[model samples]
Target chain A: MRICFYPGCSYASTAGYKESTEAVCQKLGIELVVIPDWNCCGATVMFGENKLRATALAARHFALTQAMGFEEIVTGCNACYATLGKAARLLNEDAELFIKTKDVLQALGLTLDRIPKIRHLFEILTKAMPDAPSERYRSLSVGAYYGCQLTRPHQFLDKGGYPEILETFLERIGFAVTDHSARTQCCGASHAVIYKDECRNLSARIIREISDKGAQIITTICPLCQFNLDQAQTGDLTPRIPVTYFTQLAGLALGLSATSLGMNKLLVSAEKVISRP
Target chain B: MNKASKPNPFTSISDIATINACIQCGTCSGSCPLSDQMDHAPRELFALIREGEYDMALKSNTPWFCVSCYACMVRCPKEIPVTDLMYAFKEIITRKRTAPKNQKMPDMYRAFSRIIKAKGRITESYVMALYGVKHPLDALKNIPLAVKMILRKRLEPKALSVSDPESFARLFELTEKSEDKA
Candidate 1:
C-alpha cells in the first residue's frame, strides 16, 4: 500500500516518530512516498495570528499534494494533522477564503481545487495490523495518550468524549490498555517553550493522571505530547514515567530492533519496558 | 459593560455571532486546561466580548495562554467555534496601532512565519538562534536539552531552503493583501 507522507519539521527532530514510523511501515509493507517540496503546516500560532495566512500556508501544501496526485496524505504529528485538517475544512466550507487562497496560489501557478484526506499515522497502523502481533510483548500496561488535537474539533479518528482508538490498538497488540480520562487532555504544546512554568504545571497534570492510572509506559501519537509528558517531570512531586511514540511500541511488537526504532534517544528511557519478559 | 461610545467590538469580529450563541454555561472555562492560570476564564472572556469590552478581552492574557487544544471548542453545547473566537481576540488585539510591537509571544509567532516567508520552510535551529538572541537567559537554561538533541542528530546545522523561493515570496505578499480584507 503506497501513500503520501508529510514528515513535518519535528519528524526529523523527534526521537522516535520518524524512525519507528518508517521501520514499522517497512515491516507492514506500506510504501510511504514523501511529499515533494513539503513545508510546515503553520501550526497553531499561524492560525491564531491570522486565519487567512494560515489557510494559505496550508493550502499551498494541499495544492502540492494534489499535484503529487495522491488523494490522501498521512502525518505523524498531531499539530500538523489538526492544522492541515482545519485548513482543508475551511477551504472546502468558506468559498470566500477558498477564492482568496486560490488567487494566492494562482500567482505561483498552483491550484487546489479540493482538500485531500488528512490521516494520522495511528489510523494507518491500526489498519495495517488487524490482529495480535506474532511476536507479542509482555502485557506492559500502556496509557495511550491522544493529546488534544488528534481527536478534537474532529472525531473521525475516534469518539471525542472518550477516545479508545489507542487503547484498541494497544490491546490488539497484546499490551494491557489502561483507560485514563486525561488521555485527550492538553499538553500545553508550543506554550511549553513560551510559557515554560505554566505549561509545566499543565503538563504535570496530564503526567500525574496517566501515571496514577498504573500505566508503565505512556504511549502517544503526537511528538509534542511525548516531549511535554516525558520532559515535564520537575522532580518535585510527579514521578518520571517513560513516554514514547505509539509507532515505537508497534515497531517493538513487529520485532523491529530498538536501534532501528531510535529507542535509546527517548528522554525517559523505555529500556525496562522493552526488556519485559 | 463596555463604554457605549466605542464601536461594538463583538460585531466587528467575524465570529462574534457565536459569542451570542454561548449559553454562559461555563463548559468552555471548565474544559480549559489552563483556566486556573487565566485571570479571566473563557466564560468571563466571552461576557467581556459580548459587552464590547474588546479592550479587556484583548489584554486579559486568555488568548495568549490558549494552546489551541480545541477541547473547549469540542465540548461547547451551542456548537460555537470557541477557539476561533479566541483567535479573533488575538487578531484584533494584534492590529491595534499601539499594541506592544515586540512582545515576546507574538514576536516569536511572527518570527516563525517570517522564517518561512524568507526560506519557505522552518528550520528549528534557525528558530532557536533567533529566539535565543531575544531571550538569552531563557535559552541558556535549556542548554542541557539542546545538547542532548544535538547529540541525537536531531539538530541539522544547515537545512536546505524551500525549492521555490519566488513562489513563497509571492504567496506571502498575497497573504498581506488577504489580511487587509480579512
Candidate 2:
C-alpha cells in the first residue's frame, strides 16, 4: 500500500488529477512518497530531439526511485509512463545507451545501478483497492478511455487495441462500464496543443464514439486525454459528457465528497450525473 | 569507442534494419489514426526510406503528424517499430534543420525542449506562450479555454523548477558533452 510517485510535469496543472489522486490514495491507506527533485520525463518531445538525453532524463528518475528504496516508479500521466518505460526498455536492451546514460548520471553524482519498473497509477490503484463492490455508483454509467501509450507497444497490462482492464476495474468498483471502440484511441497527444483544428477533430471523434455508445460520462486515465476530450466538447460537440479521471470516480466510490475529489475542476461538469439518485 | 564500432546515436543501423524489414503491407498506415493528415503514410515512409529516398522521408510531414499512439508499431505485420522510426525521423529532421517551412511541429518541439532545458520541468503556460510567440493567431484561439483553465486553477502562468537546480543543470551539461563526443 506504499508507492514512490512521480507526478510528472502536468500533474499539478491537469484538472484535478493531483487532487483526486491524493485524496483517493489517502483514503485507500496508500502512502505516496513522491520522488524528491524529480525532473521531467521529456514526454515524446525529447527522444525526437536526442535519444541519449531523453534516456538520461528518464534514467535520472530511475536512479531517484532507487534512492528512495523503491523498485517501481508510479506515474499518473500516460506520456510519462510510456516515456519512462521506453527509456527503461532501451537501457536494458542497448548496452551503449545504458553506459552513456550511466556516464551522464555519474557526472551529476548519481548512479543508475538499477532500472526501476515504470507503472501506471491505474495499475497501482487496482492492485491496492479491494474488489468489494459498492452500490453508491452502480447507477452511473462510464465510458472508460485508456488513451494511447498505456498498453500499446507494451502489452503487459491488457490488449493494446481494445483494453477491458478499465471496464473490469470500474465494474469491480460498482460503476456501470460502457463498451466503446475508442478505448485505446489517440487523443491527439501533445499535438493537440499545436494543431488545434485537426486535433480537435481527433479528440471529437473519440468523444462522439463513446457518447454514441450510450455512456453517461467518460472516464480517462491520462490527464492529456481528459483535457483534450473535455476541451474539445466546448465548441458544438454534442452530449457534453463530463470527462473525469478514474481517480475521481474511485474517490467517490470510497465515500469521498464530489468537491473533495476535484470533480468541480471538470469543464463539462459531472454535477448532474453524480447528483442523480 | 572507435568510430566504426560506435553506433550512430541519431539513427543506428539496427533501426534502419528494422525499417528495412517493413513489407509495405499498409497495416501501419491503416492502423494510424492520423494517417489522413500526413503527406505520406507510415507504409509509404518506410518504402521511401528503403528506396534511399532519405530526404523525402525526412521532409515528409508523416513523422511530425505521428501522435506516438504506437498503433502502427504494435500492429505492424513486420514489427518494424514504426513509432520509434518516426522518432528517429524527427531527430534527423531536427538535427538537419530540414523541417518543411509550413510545419509548426518542429517549432513546437523546440519550444517544449527549451522549457525543459531551462527549468528541469515544463510549465504548460510557458510552453504555450513561447510557442505562441511564433503563431499568434493559434494562441489567440486558445484564450477562451486558457481563461477557463486559469479560473479553475488548472493552468498556472508561473513556471516550476526542480528542487535541486544545480544537479539538474549539471545533468544536461554532461549529457551534451557526451553527445558531442558521439
Candidate 3:
C-alpha cells in the first residue's frame, strides 16, 4: 500500500531509524512516498517561540498531504508526530486560531482544509503485520521505551501510562518484552541537548529503572530517547547496555543485515545483543 | 487607540483562558517528572496564573524544564491540558524575553529557531556548532561526545536546505505580520 511519509528531519541523520524502517517496509510491501519539500515540524520549541508560526508550520504539512489527495500522513519522529497532532487538534477546536492559520497559509498560496490523520510509523508497522512472525527472539529481554511524545497529551495509539502497543507488538514478534515502570516516562526529551546536567540527572532515573527491571537491552521508538538513554550511561566502567530503535529489532526479525540497517552507528555497540545473527 | 493597538502578549497565546479552568489539583504537580527542580510545580504554577502572577509564572524554571512530556495533562482530573499550558508559558517567556537569568533553553530555542528559519530543516551537527558558538564553555565540554558521534559517521555536516526558500520565508513574514496585528 502506498502512503504519504513525513521523514521529520531527524530520520535521515538518526542512524538506524530511516534505514531500518525502509528495509522493513520494503519487505512488508509498504511503499513510502516522501512528501515533496517538507519542512521541520519545529518540534516542541517552535510553538513555544511563536504559536502562529508553529501552527502554520504544521498545517503546511497537513495542506501538502491534503493537496496530494491523501488523508493520512505518517511521521517517523515522536516530536514531529506530537507537534503535528497537537496542531491538528488546536486548528480544529479553536476557530480563531484556525482562521489565523488559514490566513497565513493563504498568504503563501496554500490552504489547510484540516489537519489530516497524523500517525507514527510504529502504529502503521504494527497494523501492517498482524500475522504471526516466523522468527522469534529466543530469550532476549527488550524494554520497549515509548518516551513522551508518542503516547502523550492525547493517547493517540494507546494509554498514557503503561501503553501496551509496543510491548504487545514486541511479544507478537516473539521477543521477550521486559516490564518496566518508565514505559511512558520522559527521557528528558529535547531539553537534554540544552540543560545537559539537569536532563542527564532525569535521564539517569529512567536508565536506572529500565536496568533494574532486568532488561538486557532497551528498545526505544524515539531518536532523542535512544540518544539520551545511550549517552546517559553512568561514568563508571560498568558495561553499557545497548539502546536500539524498534525498527532495528523488527529489521532483525525480518532477517535484514545489521550493517545495512545502520546498527553499527549505535553508541552502545549492538555487537553483544544482535551479534547472534 | 495606541494602547488598543499594543500587542498584548496574553492574547497572542491561543488558549490563555484554559488557565482559569485549572482546578488547582496537585495531579499536575504530582505527575511532573521534574517537580522538585521547578520553582513552582504545575499546581502552584496554575495558582500563580489565577493570581495574575504572569511574570512569576514565566520566570520560574518549570516551563523551561517541562520536557513537554504531557504526563500531567494525561493524568489531570480536570483535563486542563497542563503541558500545553506550560507550552503557553514557554511562549510568554520567550516573547516577553524574560527567560530567567542564564537559561540555556531560551538561547537554545533561539539558535534552534534560527537554524530552522534559515534551512527549513534540523541538522544536528550545525545546531551543535551554533549552540557551541553561544556557550563556548559548555561546547568545550561536549567535544568528546561530538567526536564520538562524528566517528560513527552520524554527522552529515552538510546542511540540507528546503527546495524553495522564498515560500518558506514568506510564511514567516506573514506570521510576523499577524503577530503585529494581534
Candidate 4:
C-alpha cells in the first residue's frame, strides 16, 4: 500500500486533486512518498521541443523513484503518466536514446539503470478502496470522464476508445455510473489555453454529451480535464453540472466531509448534489 | 546539404519506411478529434510526407492542432504511430522556427517550456501570464475564471522551484550538450 507519488506541475494547483488524493490515501493506509526535488514531466510540449530532453526530464523521475526504493511511479496527472510512460517505453526499446539519457542523468549525479513503471492515481484507488462502506452516494449519478491520455496509445488499463474501468470503479464505490460516450474525449489538453474559443467548444461538447446522458455530475481523472470541463461550463447556457476529481468522490464514499475533500474548489458547485438527502 | 537534400526529420524520430506503409486510409484522420481544425488531416500529412512534400508537411498546423490524444495512433490500421509523428513534426518545426504564422500553439508551448526550464516546475498563473503577453484579449477573457480559481486557492500566485536547483539546472545543460552531439 506504499507508492512513490509524482504530483506533476498542476496537481497541487488543480481542483482538490492533491488534497482529496492525499486525504483518501491517508485513510486507505496507502503511503504516498513524493519524489523529492522532482521536475516537470515535460508533458507533451517537451517531446515536440526536443525528444532527448523530454526523455531525460521524465527519466530523471524514474531514477528518483528507484532511489526511493520503489519500482513504480504513481502520478495523478495524465500528462505526467503518459510522458513518463513514453520515456520508459522509449528507454526500454531504444538503447541509443537510453544511453544518451543515462549520460545526461549521470552528469547531474543521478543514475538511470532501470526505468520505473508509471501508473495513474485512479489505478491505485480502484485497487485500494473496497466496495463502499455505506450507500450514502448510491443515488448520486456520476459521468466518468477518462480524458484522452490515460488509456489510448497504451491499453494496459482498459480499452482506449470506450474505457469502462472508471465506470466499474465508480459503481463498486457505490455511486451510480452513467454510461456515456465522452469517456475518452479530448478536453483540448494544454492547447485549451491558447485556443480558448475552439477548445471551449470541444470541452462544451463533452459536457453536453455527458449531461444529456442524464449524468448529474461528471468525474474526471485528469486535472486539466476537470479544469477545462468545469471552466467551460462558466457563462454556459446549460444547467451547471459539477466536474469533480475521482478522489473527491472516493473520499465522500469513505464518509469524509465534503470540505475536507476540497469539494468546495469545484467551479460549478457540487453543494446541491452532495448535500442531497 | 541544401533544404531538399536534408534528411526528412520524421526518419530521425520514427521509421519513415513504416510511415510510408500508411495505406492512405483516413482512419487516423477520422479518429482525430481536431481534424476539422487541422490544416491537413493526419492521413493527408502522411501522404504529403510520402510525396517528398516535407515543406508542406512541416508548415501545416496539423501537428500543432494535435492534443496528443493518440486516438489516431492507437486506431491506425497501419499502426503508423501517427501521434509520435506529430511530435516529430513539432520538434522539427520548433527547431527550425518554421511554424505557420497563424499558429500560436508554438509560442504557447515555448512559454510553457521556458517556465519548466527555469523553475523545474510550473506555476499556472505565471505560465498564463507569459503566454498571455501575446494574446492580451485571451488573457483578459480568463480573468474572471482566474479570480474564481484564486479565491478557491487552486491557483498559486508564487512559483514553486525544485529543492535541488543546481542539479535541475545541470540536467538541462547536460541534456542540451548530449542533444548537440546527437
Candidate 5:
C-alpha cells in the first residue's frame, strides 16, 4: 500500500528514527511515497502567531497530498501530524476561516479541495503491520507517550483526553502498553533549548510520571519530546528508562536486528530495552 | 520571600467577573508546568491581572513559556479560563519583546515567515537545508545522523521527492495577494 508522506523537520535530524522506520516499512512491504515538495505543518507557533496564515500554510500541503491521489497522508512528526490534523478540522468547522484560507491559496493558483486524512507513523504501523511476528522478545511493559500535540486541540482523532493509538500499536507488536497520566502532558517541547532548566523540570515530571506507573520502556513519535525526556537526567533521580522511536520498536518486533533499528544513536541508550531477553 | 499577600492581576478588565471566581487556592500555579521555574506563580499572574498592574503582568516571563497545557483550566474549580488569560497575556507580551531570548528561534520564525511570504507554505527540505546552511557546522553534525535515517527511510533528503512544483508555486502567489490586501 502507498501513502503520501510528510517527514517534517526533525525526522532528518533525530537519532535513529529515519533508519529504523525505513527498515520496518521495507520489511512490511509497504511503499511510502514521500509527498513532493512537502512543507512544514505550521507547528504550534504558527497557529499562535497567525491563525489565517497558519491554516492556509497547513491547508496547502493537505490539498497537494489529495491532488497526488492519496486519501491518507502519513506524517513522521507528531507536531506535524497534529498541526495538519487540527488545521483540517478547523477549516472544516469554520467556513469563514476556510474561505479566507482558500482565498489565500487561490492567489497561488491552488485550492484546498479537501483535507486528506493525516496519520502518524505509529497509526500506520498498527493498521498496516501484519500480525505474523517477524521477531519476538520477552513480554515487556512499555509506556506510550502521545504528547500534547496529537491528543489535544480535541478537534481531531480518537479522543481528546486519552488516546489509544500508540497503545494499540504497541499491543499489536506483542508488547504490553502501560496506562499513565504523562501520556498527554507537556514535555516542555520547543522550549527545550531556550528554557533548559524549565524543560528539564517538566520533562522530569513526565519521566517520573511514566516510571511511577511502571512502564519499563517509553516510546514516542516526536523527536523533541524524545530528546528532552531522554536527556533530562543528570546523576541521581534519573528513571534511566530507554526512550525509543515507535519505528525502532516496530523494527525489532519485525525481525530487524538492533543495529538496523538504529539502537546505537539513541540518546537515552535503549541498551536497557534491547538487551532484554 | 514576599509571600505574605498578593493582589489579583485579572481584576483590571471591565469584567471583574473571572477575577472573583479565583479562590486564591493556588491550583492554577500548582498545575502549571513552568510554575516552579517562574519568579512569580501563575496564581500571582492572576493576582497581577486583578490589581491593574498590566505592565507587571505583561513584563513577566511567566506568560511566555506557558506550553499552553490546559491543566489549570481542566482542574479549575471556578472554570476561570486561566489558559485563555495566559494567551491574551502572551499576545500582549509577544508583541512587546517579552519573548525568551531564543537566538535561533527568532531565525526560525523569520525563516517560517519568509517561506509563507514566498511559497505560502513551508518546504520541509528547504527549511532544513536553509537551517543547515545557516548553521553549517551544526547541520554538518546532523549529517552523519541524517544519513543513517535516510537509508532507513525515516529521514528523506529535500531533493528526493516533492509535490507538484507548479501548483506549489501558485500557492505562494495566493499568499502574496492576501498580504497585499491585508
Candidate 6:
C-alpha cells in the first residue's frame, strides 16, 4: 500500500523514528512518499484563534497530497494527525468552511478537492500488519500512548475515551500490550517549555504511571510527547524508561538494527534494550 | 444562600460545545497541577461559565494558571474540550486587560507571539534574549539556575529554530492577512 506521509517538524529531529519509518516501509514493500516543503500543522494555536484559517492551513497539506494522487496521508505527530484529521472532518461536514478555506488557498494557486483520509501512523500499521509474525517481531511487550490531541474533540478515529486501534497494532506486531490508566493522559505537550515545573510534574507522573504498569520502554506516535517524556527523566529516583516512536519500534519489528533504527540516539537512552534480542 | 442565580455568561457559539460537555465532575480542578496556586478551581470556572457567570469567572486567575495540557479534558468523564474553553476565557481576559497583575506569563506568551509576528516563527535565542531584556530579574534568577543545571549536565540546550525562513515570513504574512480580513 502506498500513502503520502507528512512528517512535520518533529519527524526530522525525533531520534531515528523518521529514518526507521522510511527504512521499515521500504522493507515491508510499502511506499512512503513524503510531502515536500510541508508547513506547520498549526497545532493548538491555529484552531484556537481562527477556525477557518487553521482548517485552510491544514487543508493545504491534504490538497497537496491529493494533488500528488495519494488518497491517504499518514502523520507521525499526534498534533499533526489530530489537526489534519479535525480539518478533514470539518471540511467534509461543513460546506461553508470548505468554501472559505478553498477560497483562501486559491489565492496561493492551490485548490482543494476533498480532504484525504488522515491516518495516524499506528492506524496504517494496524491495518497493514498481518496476524502472523513476519519474522520481524518475535516477542516484546509494547506500551502504546495516545496523547490528548489524537483522541479528543469527539471527532474522527476511535471514541474519545477508550481507543483500541493503537493497542491492536502493537499486538499484531508480536508484543504484549500493557493496559494502563494513563493511556489517555497528557504528556505536558506544548506546555513543556512554558511551564517547566508543572509540565515536568505531569510528564513525570505519566512516565511513572506507565513504568509502574511494567512497560520496559514506552512507545508513542507523537513527536512532542516523546520529546517531553524523554526529557522529563531528570533524576535517579525516576526509572529512566526510554520512549520510542511507534515507527522506530516498527522499524525494529521489521528486522532493522538499533543503529539503523536510531535506537542509540534516544534522549532517554535505550542502550540496554537495544542490546536485548 | 439564595439559590436564585442569573444565566450563564459563556453563551457564545464558540463555547457551547465546551459548556455542553461539562459534567461538573470536578476532575479538572482535582487534576490541575496549579490548582493550589490558583484562587478558584477549573470546575468552578466551568460551572460559572456553564451558569453564565462570566463576570465572576472572567474576574478570576483560573484562566492564567492553566498550562493547556488538556489533562482535564483527558480525564473528563464527559469528554469536554476544556482547554479550548480555557483559551476562550484567556482571550476574554486579554481583551479586558484584567489578567493577573503578575505580567510575567502573559508577557512571555506575548513575547513568543511577537517573535512569531516579527520573525514569522518563535526564535528561542530571541525569546531568551527578550526574556532577559524584559524581566532582568527573571534572567538573573535563571542564569545561575541554568548555569548550575548545565554544569550538572541536566540541561541540554536544544534551541528552537525554524527550518524555513520564507515559510515563516509567509506565516507572518498570513497572520497579517487574517488580521486584515478581520
List TM-scores of chain B, every candidate: 0.87, 0.87, 0.84, 0.90, 0.57, 0.72
lDDT measured at residue A43 in model 4 versus the true structure, 0 to 100: 87
Q: Write the per-residue lDDT of candidate 1 for residues B65-90, one digit (tens) a residue.
A: 77899988989999888888777677
Model 2 interface CAPRI class: medium
What's the lDDT for all of these models?
0.80, 0.85, 0.80, 0.85, 0.67, 0.68
Native contact recovery (fnat) for each candidate is 0.63, 0.75, 0.75, 0.81, 0.24, 0.08
TM-score of every model?
0.95, 0.95, 0.93, 0.96, 0.74, 0.79
Ranking by TM-score: 4, 2, 1, 3, 6, 5
**Which residue pairs in candidate 3 collide?**
none
lDDT of 6 at A99: 79
Worst 10-residue lDDT window for candidate 6 chain A reads A132-141
Clashing pairs in 6: B8-B51, B8-B52, B9-B52
Better of 3 and 5 by lDDT: 3
Model 1 per-residue lDDT tens digits across residues A196-261: 776777788888888898888889899889877877775675888888899998888887888899
* DockQ, all candidates in order: 0.64, 0.59, 0.60, 0.69, 0.21, 0.21
- What tens-digit string does per-residue lDDT give for candidate 5 at A1-277? 7768887756665767778888888887878898766666667566545456667878878777767887888887777877787688777877877888877777765657777777777777877776637445546788888776665554255564677878877787767778988787888876664455446677888888888888888998787787667767655756788888888888887778878877777666777666773
Cα deviation of A169, candidate 6, in Å: 2.4
Candidate 6, residues B16-119, lDDT tens digits: the string is 55556776778888877667666777888767665666567767877667655566766778767676667666655665577767645666666655554444
Answer with 3 or 4, whichever has the higher TM-score: 4
- Tell how far residue A120 is off in model 1, in angstroms: 1.3
> Which candidate would rank higher by DockQ, 2 or 4?
4
TM-score preference between candidates 1 and 6, better one = 1
In model 5 chain A, the worst 10-residue window by lDDT is A151-160
Q: Write the per-residue lDDT of candidate 3 for residues A1-277, one digit (tens) a residue.
A: 9989999877886758888989889999999999998998989888777788998899998888888889999987898999999899888888888898888888888878767888998988998864446455647888889998888878868887878998898888768878988888787777777667766767777777877888888899988888888877858623378898998888877778888788888888887776652
- Runs in model 2 lying further than 4 Å from the true structure: B1-13, B177-182
Off by over 4 Å in 1: A234-236, B10-12, B97-103, B180-182
Tell me, by TM-score, which candidate is best.
Answer: 4
Per-prediction backbone clash count: 0, 0, 0, 0, 24, 3
